[model samples]
Target: MELKWTDTLDIAIELDEAHPDVDPQYIRFTDLHRWVTELEGFNDDPERSNEKILEAIQMTWIEEKD
Candidate 1:
């Protein structure tokens, strides 16, 4: 499935699987943005992301990690 900015939980799950050794809580938003865009199934516009979206993604990732 193609990923979108609003797919925070799904994106988090994918990131969790992709980077199992990394801690989401400690990740920088810049790195998180890059990772999300690089995700295999991600097809959304990279420019569409904002701070709020990134934060949601990070929060979801942290939750998924635990």
Candidate 2:
């Protein structure tokens, strides 16, 4: 399934799986933005994302990690 900016939880899951060695708690928004756009099945416009969206994704990723 194609991923969108609204797919925070799913995106978090993908990130967790894709970067198993990375710590989501320490990731910067800039790198997070790049990673999300590069993810497989991600099809949302990168420009549509804001700080809030990135925060949600990061929070979900942290949850996934734990």
Candidate 3:
């Protein structure tokens, strides 16, 4: 499962991601998920199936307040 942008998997952006206050918006979301997958090494193991990923995502029933 290589991470990449596909026409079916992406949405149109109304505005260009350009900001000076913090890291550029392009860097923020561009290949954003790719980095997460790489860091988690989710693609390295063939035994760990999608069901494992689903199990990993515990439904966040609790909310945090500031």
Question: Residue-wise lDDT of candidate 1 within 1-66, one digit each (tens)?
Answer: 899999999999999999999999899999999999999989999999999999999999988877
| lDDT per residue (tens digit) for residues 1-66 in model 2 | 899999999999999989999999999999999999999999989999999999999999999888
Which scores higher on TM-score, 1 or 3?
Answer: 1
Better of 2 and 3 by lDDT: 2
What candidate 1 gets wrong by more than 4 Å, as runs, is none
Compare candidates 1 and 2 on lDDT and give the better one: 2
Error of 2 at 2 (Å): 0.5
> Which wins on lDDT, candidate 1 or candidate 3?
1
Q: Candidate 3: which pairs clash?
A: none
Model 2 residue runs over 4 Å out of place are none
Top lDDT model: 2
lDDT tens digits, residue span 15-50, model 3? 111212322222333333333334321334433335
Q: After superposition, how far is residue 31 of candidate 2 from its true place, in Å?
A: 0.3
| Candidate with the greatest TM-score versus the true structure | 2
Predictions in order: lDDT:
0.95, 0.97, 0.25
